[model samples]
Target chain A: MPDKFRGNLLALAVMVCLYERPMHPYEIVLTLRQRHKEESVRLNYGSLYAVIASLLKRGLVAVVGVERQGRLPERTVYCLTDSGKEEVHQWMADLISTPTREYPSLAVALTFLPVLSPDEALRLLKERALSLETRLVQGQASLQWVQRHGLPRLLWIEAEFLLRLTEAELQYVRELIGEIEAGTLEGTDFWKALHESQELSLGIILSEKAQYPEETGIRAGGQGTAPRKRTRHG
Target chain B: MPDKFRGNLLALAVMVCLYERPMHPYEIVLTLRQRHKEESVRLNYGSLYAVIASLLKRGLVAVVGVERQGRLPERTVYCLTDSGKEEVHQWMADLISTPTREYPSLAVALTFLPVLSPDEALRLLKERALSLETRLVQGQASLQWVQRHGLPRLLWIEAEFLLRLTEAELQYVRELIGEIEAGTLEGTDFWKALHESQELSLGIILSEKAQYPEETGIRAGGQGTAPRKRTRHG
Candidate 1:
């Protein structure tokens, strides 16, 4: 299998559609939309054509037949070759079996979290918790609707997994917020003190300048020479 | 406040480094690496310089001084402007509080799970469960090591969140595998029957061809014309 087909969900979806029966590009689009596979796989006409052309070149799909409907353009139908079928199975297996490294935005955010003031951090986190709660409720309702329509859970299992992930994040975020609010989070004092000292230092600088006007002028003049020295070096 | 900086983790990391104090690019890189931030943020010297340049152009970082050590080239030291500090806080808050949509590969795979045989899916999922378990153990050990070093949890909270997500996914995959094995998955019967019927049809077709060679020849001859007819249309 080519590397392009290995991790390409859109290509995998196209192949899976062909697995059931030969289909033209239009039929494949309709089937994917009807199955709501578009939610997981990015679908666009240009990319679909590009994928089909690539798959054809790779011998994963064969041009089975062409059809015409009155004055319409000829539509080339395609079917998965044996190699394509094998690729689909192997690709799906690899995706399900492997845990690849992914960088979630939230994880990146939390890693540099000390950038925000503690109070502001708490406020933002609370907002996130609320958003997650709303999403959980919406996800639950959507899943229940699908169940009510007699759709099998297997078909919508991705949604279930996503909901579970969201629930876990919400739980973790809530606990973190609690720890911060209770002043028990590790390094909370240091994080808080860092900001406090910044403010204190700023205040001290202002007060000292106000109290010693002539001395401040001499110091400012002396500091001004540093930039001139840098200019000379440049 | 530029959209470019909104979700730019590298830019955020750079700004946060300057928030500490004025530092040249080299010092910023050294600081980020010393704090083990490269694990969460993608860092490359070229992109780091590009991010710094963008931040400088946006007036978020000001060149505070220039430094030269021995024969080394002069390095411009940068510090965050007041606006830069505000942007950092707002960006961090937005990232922490916002629950954006992300497409995980596993979720995409599960959406198309029916593409594989139930047996294969179960086997692959079991492998995933094992991998997740091993990762969980490794992650725990690493976190313990950091804790033993007396590093605050706040510094490594992203790892904690990642571990929690991994645990959630592992639990879900295991349950799915169990349901499939026990024949309790909602569509297990349908899924199994689909593959079985495909195999049965192939067997029947082969047996029919052997038993009625004359009729099979006619069908093959008819199918042979399909390509010719398509060629005419082309």
Candidate 2:
């Protein structure tokens, strides 16, 4: 099997590869594809150029050298900057770090619970469904492209994997609408959560305890300090 | 339990809140704490500023309206732009369509088979461990600060949850090193597959492969192609 980087991780992978030897962009692409393992990392010039520019801007990488073949286009090669090297070093040190976040949309959606009406939340859910549908269309298109392009076996994995996740959300949303319609779930934490999400402010979030006095009070509906003491740790 | 935004979805939470009301940085912070349930979203200035700025730059959000809020201490209220509203709409729609990726650093790290020499790979792993350690340390510090400041219900779930994840990764990395040394685990594909990582460029990888074609042939390790028409699609 081969190594892979996903999304932003591509930057780090590029850093890792550059650490070994300076590489031209075309060389970089060809090298990645030849490994057969890096199909996802395999990028067109637009994406690659964008990343390279971003890396230079971030001071994580630089143009170490460039080369031109007799009749071929001039090639610009890139390498890790000291900062880039340090970043890679730091990232390696953090390899054992835990998987912290859940998902982008879900994480963000929960925050604005307070301000939005229940109807609005439902509306948002529906909109997300539409986005997923778009993605599905895109995924299917890519799948066809890959098969037709004579791409190797793994090309479909990402598209398929992403689709599976999308499908799960689609089903969950349908189930959610059902819960809403049936009135089996209502007038509860869901509403409050939305409120709290709406309420997020720097002062309030950092001074969480001070602001959330309502939650701690007997009336706020949660059991008190028992859970609190434990998180106070070394 | 509140109908927690499924997976602590932060982006949706923030976007929705902003759509309903444009809050100055500090106000947004205050709300998240006050509104937290057993589990809730956490947003700090750095991240908050970044997202808001990005949104504003992209025209997804506008300073459509602002509040004076007494300028001895300056503050600008943020309201979503019309486009921002559309974006939030689309964001929700997308969420409904996709599956969320979990924390998979170790898995992602493993994707770059043979890209890094054993030493370089080990170095990369160490960096990851360190980065996790730093975040854990920062999160704990924040947790303590919030606890002392008297937050509501001390909504500690997020910091604690993140801490545990980081701890898990540290342990996973140690085990990974052992597996590598034992030679019981070899092949880039295994790491790539497990991690759902992106692939490396074939140029550098192919050169390495060509060095030892006997070990890798037409099927060529984990490149995007199906191995022997293996029918991997689900």
DockQ per candidate, 2 decimals: 0.25, 0.12
B1-234 in candidate 1: lDDT tens per residue?
755556568888888777766788877776665454565676678888888988899899999988887999889999989999789777887788888776778988898787777888888999888888888887787777767766677777887888888889989998998899999888778778767765523221111112111111111011122111111123
Task: List, residue by residue over A56-112, the lDDT tens digit for candidate 2.
Answer: 887778887677768777778898777786676555444423333432344334333
Which candidate number maximizes lDDT? 1
TM-score between model 1 and native: 0.74
Q: Across all candidates, what is each one's fraction of true contacts kept?
A: 0.58, 0.13
Per-prediction TM-score: 0.74, 0.48
Error of 2 at B52 (Å): 5.3
Per-candidate alpha-carbon RMSD to the true structure: 14.5, 11.8
* lDDT for each candidate structure: 0.72, 0.49
Q: Per-residue lDDT for A104 in model 1?
A: 75
**Candidate 2, lDDT over the whole model:** 0.49
Model 2, residue B187: distance off in Å is 4.3
